[model samples]
Target: MKKLLVITVFLVAASAFLFGATYRIGLSLSTLNNPFFVTLRDGALQAAAGLGVEVIVADGRDNPAKQLGDIEDFVQQKLDLIVINPTDSDAIVTAVEEANKAGIPVITVDRGASGGMVIAHIASDNVAGGMMAGEYVAMLLGGKGNVVELEGIVGTSAARDRGEGFGAAISKYPDIKIVAKQVANFNRAEGLVVMENILQANPNIDAVFAHNDEMALGAIEAIKAAGLLDKIKVVGFDAIDDAVAAVNAGEMAATVAQQPFLMGQLAVVKAFEYLTIGTIYIPVDLQLVTSK
Candidate 1:
């Protein structure tokens, strides 16, 4: 009887090994309202399906508190791994630390946590992309023009790093004075309202550089409303489909392109690799996209 039991146990173990374990991964996105993040989510879902792994996605709706709740829920579910696209770098640190304490590995995509144990980070060089946009704006205006700057969400890495890079690049051009600098919160509606106010204050603005395409598009509407579209050049980051179309239509000067879909796909692949073999880090590239 004992010999027969041992044989049955060995067969069960072998069968389990032959069929590969399915890892459960949690994907928490900052917001799905934005087209860029929606594409990212789709890419991740596609990769997970190919690998036969289960991915539970949570949308934070651009709320930091809600994002923290999502991470907590993922922890309570005992997921194999957690991937986060933080809304605010500082606000996400606490949630990441909680995941760390729970012994769940964490990976950050796009924005990073200010304090936490992250196995890997996947994103583009926002600073370089911002610098490119600033340089293009300067060239468009011949290095001497009144410019307006539209910033993204506050306390986010993308917003801070991109703003830093743009500031650094524009500092070299002494004559290119920034007449108005305001935060649009990366929302198109807010961008339009803020830009309309800025236009009223700075009537001689020659160019506008927005941290993201949504804001750039908003600024364009404001400029057009003011009947100054032909006079002012607009540059934006994140060459999303609509932004690229705007460039082609000659309504936008240029935009910096980042492969958000690839970032999402790689995040899933790297998470699987980390669970199986080891750790890995990837930095995606960026390029300038202009009307052709």
Candidate 2:
């Protein structure tokens, strides 16, 4: 009787050890300064709570080297899964490879890594979103106008894909000319400065398309300061709250909305799924938000 009792207790302990184990996931975001990324982080936290998993979030702060260091820390900690929103597509490959060498699967959210064995990628179709913005801008200008383009960070996949799509769409209309193109690094302050310079250099600007809402908002400020807000239409991507408000107030023409919260939620959920059974790539939806 004593032996049987001991065996029963041991079995219960073993079962608990095997079944009650909690998973730890690491999420490295490019930057939390942007409202869009903040929403993404919140969504990831919410999903982690529901799943009863531990999530260690690291803010890259828009620095590639810092982000790489964060990934190395996660690898050393032996986390089950690592999710990255890369600051630079090409620069993040080394970090992703390091995680892979540690036998820790890596997943990417929003932007992609140029070369890495990412288990799965979760993001919206940025190229399609950019094309949508371009088509809308062309329609607003009756297929003929002088346009300015405010680009995002040069090495980011979001910037490259969006620019490709926008250029492809604009190429269809021969009357529409891109007079000035400048890099704002997806920053509002830089957007204002770049737009101000473009405005000064080119007086016949009819429309502007910015890779992100932050930059678009900046351009709007410059245009407003120059007292040309009514004359020039502005379009932006990421459909952040401020950009949406601008659209509703007739201060901006349109914006392509990507679900950052949903992207974050799925990144966590998918990481958990891959750790358990298996998972596949996920592409979130995008919408063109305009006053109409």
Candidate 3:
């Protein structure tokens, strides 16, 4: 009887030791406070939880240094995987390199890390989204007009790609010139203030292209406040609910929509595959999804 009891106890202990260990995945985000990114977090968490993988989240809150610190923490914890939404691309190189050295797969979600290679990049085609915004605005203005560009966080891929795409598209229409452009840091408040000033100088501005919905909404508010609502057609990227509502209401022209939830889902799914299958993707630009 004693021997049988001991065998049962050993079996239980071994099972606990094997199955109770959680596989931790590091999640580093640009801003936990932002609603769009909040959806990303929720989706990521849900996916990870469904797979019984532990997720360690690090909030950068729009700071590069904080993101680096969070990455370091994940490395120290020896996490199975690391997911990053870099605050700025250039600032995250060292930390991403560290994760690679530690044999942990690094997945870049939405905003990419600057000057570093990662296991996978999961995001909408920001360049295409930008070009879409530009084309939409040009068509809205009947292919020729003076427009102002409300840019996102400078130097990030989204900002650079979107701006470049928009610029390239607008160049096709020689008469459609960008009247003024400056970084609004992807913040609505900054967008409003910047557009308010631009309104003062370029009252005859025919359109406005904001790199993201937050900035576009702000620009719309500023345009209305300055009594130029009907005069300027506004186009923005990232179809946040507010932006879509504005589009439906005819308050703003249109927005290039990015699937934030899908970005999160893909990142989680890819991270799981890399950990389990040891797969390496062929070099191809994997654009997740972006739309109207």
Candidate 4:
């Protein structure tokens, strides 16, 4: 009877620790398929584990409705907080509001919503990265060239800021013209097909500015297959491993490296701080990350 009583006491203590110890946070990613986001997710996972927080993974899959649903579920579950990689800025407003209504903080990563204030917004300087891409290509072509630009998903801040910044940078060199521009939706397959067509149609193209490295690598493949490997220069954003290798091999010119892991880690760190301090740490001015 004595042994039984001790074991029962131990089991009750273990159960209490398990339930009481968890600091649950809900996570919503823009898309689980993107390598950039995968790195970000890894950082969030690591940070949450280190902080003894439970992260409930939710896949947005680049769908605003899906992301909203996931956030609603989190609100219903009464999770501690939320980390959102918004699919669309406008569409994410209500979802962030939902978190706010539940008294749960929302930390945005990679993308920010247009409304419903969040605890923190974690992202790289996408606009500056685009400027770097444009300058690198212009330098490669001696400030005069016909360039084809590969864009990411339209409407999102990443694509819009990158395109606008790159356009502004390239406009400084009047001789450099964007012969063609197309949205590849940030997918490798779309990039390959679109770039192939662009190459066939624009045989006089001098370079390419891909908004992200995946599309840039895809464009490189198409350029090689079309027999324009050495004739065309390619600049991309996000110094992913393959892009770095290509840069070293002379297949790609340069990439604006964004520390995606750091972005995610900061988001998680801020989320925890919001829980404890009820505030965030987003800087008052621009935080830019540019260069290889």
Number of the top lDDT candidate? 2
Enumerate residue pairs that collide in model 1.
none
Worst 10 residues of 4 by lDDT: 1-10
lDDT string for model 4 (40-86, tens) is: 88888876766667888888887889989999999999998899988
Lowest summed lDDT across 10 adjacent residues in model 1 is found at 1-10
The sequence of per-residue lDDT tens digits that candidate 1 reaches over residues 1-292 is: 2353234334433443466656899999999988889989987887677666789999999999999999999999999999999999999999999999999999999998899999989899999988998898889988999998999999999999999999999999999998899999888888899989988877899999999999999999999999999999999888999999999999999999988887787778778766654455332445899998
Q: Rank the candidates by lDDT, best first.
A: 2, 1, 3, 4
Model 4 residue 238 CA deviation in Å:
1.0
Q: Could you tell which candidate, 1 or 3, scores higher by lDDT?
A: 1
Candidate 1, 231: how far from true, in Å? 1.1
- How close is each model in CA RMSD to the real structure? 10.1, 10.0, 9.8, 9.8
For all candidates, the clash counts are 0, 0, 1, 0
Error of 3 at 101 (Å): 2.8
C-alpha lDDT of candidate 3 relative to the true structure? 0.82
Model 1 clash number: 0
Pairs that collide in candidate 2 are: none
Q: For candidate 2, lDDT tens digit of each residue in 1-292? A: 2353234334433443467746899999999888889999998888777667889999999999999999999999999999999999999999999998999999899999999799888888999988998999999999999999999998999999999899999999999999998999999999999999998988789999999999999999999999999999999999899999999999999999999888888787777666654454233445899999
- What are the Cα lDDT values of the candidates? 0.87, 0.89, 0.82, 0.82
List candidate 2 segments past 4 Å from native: 1-18, 278-292
* Candidate 3 weakest lDDT stretch, 10 residues: 1-10
